[model samples]
Target: MMIPLAPATIAAPFARYSHGVEVPAGWRLAVCSGQLGMASDGTVPESPREQADCCFANIAAILAEAQMTLTDIVRINAYVTDRAHMQGYMDSRDAHVGTPPPASTLMIVSGFTRPEFKVEIEVIAAAP
Candidate 1:
């Protein structure tokens, strides 16, 4: 099984995420490309929360193809267009991730390929 690490010496994580994750030997790993907040139908939602949800949904579909689920995720890297979108993204992330949530990083970026895109997410998952 994967291990979640949060050393006592270090400050606790700011949110629902582990400081780091230790993937065991002989496990299969899948790394997904950053997914934008666009739907399969090419629709982009105006709300940041809705867009974040779409990003997670896309990630889920990708993980499913590798016979893995979000629970197997070990790390997550997310980007938002502005600080205002942080909470929305965090809310969706908290809802989607499994227990002992994966190590995570969130950043505020200038923009994305499309102006309407508010969030982008990528993940690394490992399973035995």
Candidate 2:
């Protein structure tokens, strides 16, 4: 399980977010490369939300390939071209993760491998 690390004083106020913490022991760790919004047939979606969905879907598929789920993710690195769409992506992510969300870093980049593509996501998972 992902444990939030923080002193009692610091963590009380920021209970919504986990304190800097450590990954549990004996868990299988997997580092996934940045997944673009390309479909299985190499089609990139035009909408940012669509792309973000596709990217996360691709990530989920990859994690499943290794017998993992989103709950096993400890960290997520998200790259998006538009800031307006970031919240949507986060919402989608929350929908996927449900509870005990992973630590995530969201970035706004200038462009991507495909101009139509709007988001890419990379993840690190620790399986218990």
Query: TM-scores of all models?
Result: 0.98, 0.84
lDDT, candidate 1, at 32: 96
For residues 1-128, what per-residue lDDT tens digits would candidate 2 score against the true structure? 78756576653522222434468778888899998878888887777677777877888888998899877778888898888878767766776662466767788999886687778889888877
What lDDT would each prediction earn against the true structure?
A: 0.94, 0.75
RMSD of each: 0.6, 2.7
lDDT, candidate 1, equals 0.94
- Badly placed stretches (over 4 Å) of model 1 are none
lDDT of 2: 0.75
- Number of the top-ranking candidate, with lDDT as the measure: 1
